[model samples]
Target: MNDVLFRTGGHAARITLNRPRALNSLTHDMVLRIDAKLTEWEHDPAVGTVVITGEGERGLCAGGDIRAIHDDARDGDGRASAAFWRDEYRLNARIAHYPKPYVAVMDGIVMGGGVGVSAHGSVRVVTERSAIAMPETGIGFVPDVGGTHLLARAPGELGTRLALTGARIGAADAILCGLADHYVPSAALGDFVADLAERPVREALARHVRQAPPGVLAGRREWIDSCFAADTVEDIVQRLLDHGGPEAREAAETLLTRSPTAVKVTLAAVRRARGLGALERVLDQEYRVSCACLGSPDLVEGIRAQVVDKDRAPRWSPATLGEVADADVERFFTPLGDRELGLAGDGPLTAPGTAGPGAGR
Candidate 1:
């Protein structure tokens, strides 16, 4: 019920996400419903365009309902969890290639699955209060929902830095990082969206946009690149510690406290995604790794400590990034064997994180 809202106005089809209580966090049912609606609109002649937005003022979508995945795994339902992710990934791909003008009114907190749903659109609008991030590593997961594709395109090691640290970026920083296309004031979203409902083309919407200040991350390029360039998280940590500044030292301590295996594997996944020719391939590789992490102790422990238990401290399987080995990392990427992420139609494989076997453990 609190999933999707569909309405037709003028020549446009509007899809409003309705789960504001949880920041419109996506569930498996929501994912399938969105896919169905998009498919319906794609073939409908009266619908000349589509708009995707969320309810409430707090945010767009936070991400997927990981609580369900956690529950499924606890019940020996890893395959079921993987199936949901596969469908979700397919929906993400559909948004990316939709033929019409797909406009995303990204307001408050947009992240993870939210990024995938809206970032691939023909038009992406951000606002002053917009807080965007891909913080999967912090939760013992890799950035999925085609997030790796966008992260791969980010300037320098900025993607890796964001992925590993779960750092929140403002509208300015988001625009600078290529995550947002246009910036309109947060106060103007309601009026702009209303106006947009009447105007169906790209150019008409551009007139409503007020020029925004350049992104905040523009000046921090040198520092971010230099700090994140290190190959290993430990190396980056050392660099941060050596910098003798509050920012660098604070970042280093933050990384040290995160799941060590998560940081290490996330770095490798980010680097690998950069080399892939397409998003599908990267997602495929991610699926294999994610399946391997099904039995991983860290996935459950991390979720319990952070989401279920609300405890700040997580007891990681490998307590430090330095403790994760190349073999331990390689296991995640190993082929799914017979347990492939197959779907009914044209769908993309999606892994929970960019990790190898034992990642969950």
Candidate 2:
């Protein structure tokens, strides 16, 4: 079977990830297939909505196939890697702006690229087994896949914390943090998909659910707001060091272990993209940052230590947090000219403030 499957049933177009072994890790081809299907369905009169799910119980998607990315980077032809990101980012923009209802079964692992596909959907269902995270920091990359946009909208420094630490949150936390909408048991996904296949009854199914998922960081808002209120990464770290609790302290430690240059540039990028730019524009900015990641010192070294060598210690450029220069960090936002990803001036897929549930929150 194809790694990614696209079909039409009833009023909804069904897209399924067929990879179970790798937890449905999305490769570049899978992304292309998904985009092609979405394009085809856009104009198809028979299809009314779209539902995305995975083949196995392990995850909707673990993330992109980073191993392939690492190898492409190793070969010095970062062009292919860049193309993958460009197309993937475009797909994310399409989904975010898609006109019809987009439903996602966010059971099991949903992280990194998976968030781009599922989080922005009109109906995002999480289960007890849901494990959501933006773990790009662990691999020496900023959280792309439109995660920066979501992070930008998160309350206060909570966005910064998730972007930097690569921490995982359960179903309850995913809802509280605005990453997911509804909560349902994983076992119910089959019936849910079956229902979607028969007709457009999402409103009715939503009302039939039992107790909702718990909130992951409910009471920590005050602390998250206070600690992340700093102007810069260093300032935030200092704030955490001064008065944060165990959660804040541990998050601080995670940041310290990441590439200093990457952490700084990522934080700055997230903050800048918050209000001034829309989702696609911010994704374009992320494209520039990702392209530069190949030429930069942090990405390769990070992959070597974390993925290849398995040493768990990356020697970041400038070596320490204090050495990252403001100018150096600014280069990430610089335009790539012809290499840039462009979008038309027409309206987005969804209305400005109506993308999915709790959009722009």
Candidate 3:
């Protein structure tokens, strides 16, 4: 079956992610097709708006097909996974910059690649059912698809906590973190979608949008800001552990469960992404980091423990965060030689030995 379905009527073109059992996890082909359809719709005078939704009540998307990535990493060369990320990241950039109104209906669980497609859109709609997150650290990978770009810009160090813990947030927190725009109740979603088929996105949103239920992040911001502000992952963990609050110490425990290398690399990527500024530049940086992850033992083991083996206990290489050296983390940022994603549209980043202007470091 087609993993994605497409149709157009009235002023809008719609795309639905169709793999319900797997929660609409994206495959490389799905990424390519979505990009092609967007390119086609961009030029069509009848398509004033573009809407994306998932087929199931479960969620919009879970993430990339990690089972496929696990197989590729364990048995095949890493090139296929890298190629998939290359195209997926490009599609994310297109969605962010797309000229027409791009409306993403984020209901139920959305994570990783789900956040990639929805959070970057011009108009992001969330529901009471929305449980949004990047959650890449849990799978021994850093956030890609402009996630670091969005995370780095969130208020204070809230992004830092979410990145390390791979925590899920509801609609209010998502809006507070700039990951979503308006909130509509889950019951209103059907009418909201029907309205999008005939009216402008703003008008459709106006009809159904309502205040989101309260989120927990705002109350925890004090501790989240203080604990996650440290420069290094170890320091961040230390701060969390030192903080007296039950939630703060709980956050520390959650960090300890993550892949040490992945956590360190994530902290580095998000910090560098903050400096990188532009979404394209940050995405270029993410491509390098993601490709480096394909080479890591943790990426395979994490997926094995979490997804394949269903063990929930990942034996991360190096075993502890203290063992992950600065040099080791830096390797993820190394220029990809001739294979660089170069999405900055200006110039490639300089060698690791030298950090140039707008280097996106």
Q: Return the top candidate by lDDT.
A: 3
* Residue-level lDDT for 72 in candidate 2: 77
Candidate achieving higher lDDT, 2 or 3: 3
The local distance difference test score of each candidate is 0.76, 0.81, 0.89
Question: What local lDDT does model 2 show for residue 336?
Answer: 92
Cα lDDT tens digits for candidate 1, 140-184: 777777677777778987777888888898887777677777888
lDDT of 2 by residue, 1-361 (tens): 7999888878879999999998898888999999888878877888877889988878999888877778778776898889999889988888877767788889899988899899977678889898999988667788898898888887767787888778888887788777887777877777787777676655536644556665657778777788877888898888888774887888788888988888888888788878646887788888888988877767877878876899988877778889988998898888899889864333565555544443322
Per-residue alpha-carbon lDDT of candidate 3 for residues 253-288, written as tens digits (9 for 90 to 100): 999999999999999999998998888899999999
State every prediction's TM-score relative to the real structure.
Answer: 0.91, 0.92, 0.95
Q: How much lDDT does candidate 3 score?
A: 0.89
User: In angstroms, how far off is 258's CA in candidate 2?
Assistant: 1.2
TM-score of structure candidate 2? 0.92
* Top-scoring candidate (TM-score): 3
Question: Comparing candidate 1 with candidate 3, which one achieves the higher lDDT?
Answer: 3
Q: Alpha-carbon error at 192 in model 2, in Å?
A: 1.1
Task: Give the range where candidate 2 is weakest over 10 consecutive residues by summed lDDT.
Answer: 352-361
User: Which 10 consecutive residues of model 3 have the lowest summed lDDT?
Assistant: 352-361
